[model samples]
Target: MPLLRLLCATLLLAAAAHACRDGGTSGEPPPAGGGGGGGGDGGGDGGGGGGAPTTPGWIERARENFEGGALPASAFAPDPVPDDGPFSDGGAYFTSRGVTPPAAFRATQPFGKDGWLTVESYSRRGDARLADHAEVVADPAGGANHVLRLRSQQHTDGTVVRPTAPLPSRYRVSLRAGFPAFGDGEAGGNNGYDAGDETAGPWWPEERAASQNGFYWLTILDALPRPHNNTWIHHHRKVVIDSDNHHPAWMETWTGDEFVWSGEHPIMMIALDGSRPGDVKTGNAFFSWSNGAWQPSGAIRAVDAYLPDRWYRVTIERDGPRYTLEVSGTFRYGGEGTYRAEIDAAQRCVWHYPVDAAEAAGAAGCVDEGAFVEGHPRWPAGGAWPDWFMFGDPHVNYYEGEVYYDDVVLEVWRD
Candidate 1:
């Protein structure tokens, strides 16, 4: 049964140049690098600077596990919150006060715990009209425990931020915050912020300004497969937004200007507008999760959870390739052994097949099998297929939202 289960589950991996097996020929001169050309290696060659390919280690591991019928049942490795001083997990966390920025913007202060350092927009693409600011600070909560805080607001035109440095691959990111919701429908709602810049290009609407849009709290996983943008991994959580309504908050993950996550590196974006344990759903808080993948993968479950207006800690650790989500110290969703067995027994589900750029470009990569997400409260209605949200444009995504992000940590398993 386990073998059958494993066999039934399809493996979704982004094609990388290294992943593309050489036609099994020795001394083959690699093809010339150019813009929009025919097949070179396999997938990763997505028309970038020299079209750099990715290492094929993780993909190989996934295939080996799947082909063997079931992934090795290793015990869930305990990810202990380190006892080192000053939010120091010793080797667990890398604190960077100096987060690099792109060419258009420079850091007012390198990232640090001393004071609130921020990045302001001076000009974008020779346009001096852009006005936006991002502030980051680290606060010492208790003995050796610190929280990193970030607030980004783009109030005017031509404001944007691309991380100074690329985040390590295969890391989980979660945030805690209160959001002021807006807009009635997905596109019209005043979520919090608006995105208007040249990068958004033709998709940038000069007339219709999107309100209730900006993210008060947003989580992003960086450096995923190209073409399809960030490699998004879905996770399950029993969360109640400020609305106290039963709708699940979206944990959207993306890379750069793209609102897609079909490649790798899934990020988490949750909505905690008005949710408290055993409390009445009062406020109207919400968020959305979307991706470019053909299918999405992850877990979403409920628990007693936490309350708003207070500091709550959410942690997720992947045991091997599987994920485990925890709130405070208890397991709410996605864990192993007792946790995994319980969640699976309670809810049987599947994810959408992540769309592949290589596959789209006619490579022998995995294509979309179907969108069969069970157990999720927001599962699209029966017989209705899940598709991408109409975010105006395809290439440029004006992600404008308001949220406070602190104690940001990322762990990548490259074994």
Candidate 2:
């Protein structure tokens, strides 16, 4: 089975989200020259500079993992939450097609009730329940009738909620989020076992390969593969916008201490596969992970800023291949910033036949078989678009913390 399916199955059976291991931490700050900032054409070949320094070593390691057979079994853990109840009160709106813009297709959730949200634990170090970490209670701050309360206890936990229907091509998603003022000090060590405090958290052991310590994440799952021979193409396609409370560089291995505090930074990332301008897969070819491999197409860092006990509005809009992410509010660090990224599908590349076919033909034929070709007609079918939106720490591990979310709105465009 594919890695993602296996993960979902495991979580379904186990009744908790605990796939993947915790990442190790190093006391050293992310190497110099790693800061990310500034904005330009989101599709430019130039790597976004001025934020966190690039961690080439970590990237290389992730590449190796992608190429080296399947992701580690250790990486395929279970999500603690169950898929129960409706994702939204507005049914059938998500699947309605061709309804043009200015026309609103919204799924608003206030979190005042309990049936709409599903919470799961994503850590392996300790025993924690989704209910223990998440709750739908009256807002003490008196902003809304009910708010989604998420707490990161000894492990990194998350919650998943889908829309009433699939999202349209052009739409705006806005939500109010705040990190409550609470401190838990430090807890774990550097060797993948230590759960750091509010400042030191964990990252996905299988991807990115680092921790953000004390931060919040809102991930949107855009595309998913259909049930067919070529399903891997849609797996793991999503956008991740995270607030990095503790700036840590990606590590090549799990060999560092947990308490190293770097600083604070906010990041936006898009994960996809596509060829570069000068790559062999030019023309009609586009990138596809048919063989179960993925690469980060873009990682843009926003201004390094965030404040506790303050509410901020985060909006993510997708139009065609372009995505615009913005954050605003008193606690917002990047200001009323607009960051864009365009995915050039024409530059995608795909291998002909399978790796085994090339291997059977010897070195010369192997090279020919491995060559990039035009993407299939069904390359980016409707199944490859986002259908759900989620919040909280999906795949990161942390010691302890609390986050609050309210007033989520999803708006669809006509033109």
Q: Which candidate wins on lDDT?
A: 2
- Candidate 1 is scored at a TM of 0.31
TM-scores for every candidate against the unseen true structure? 0.31, 0.44
List model 2 lDDT by residue over 180-212, tens digit each.
532322223331223332222111133221234
Residue range with the least summed lDDT across 10 consecutive positions in model 2? 58-67
Candidate 2 lDDT at 26 equals 33
lDDT of 1 at 407: 38
> What ranges in model 1 sit over 4 Å off?
1-132, 137-152, 155-201, 204-212, 216-310, 325-365, 368-401, 411-415
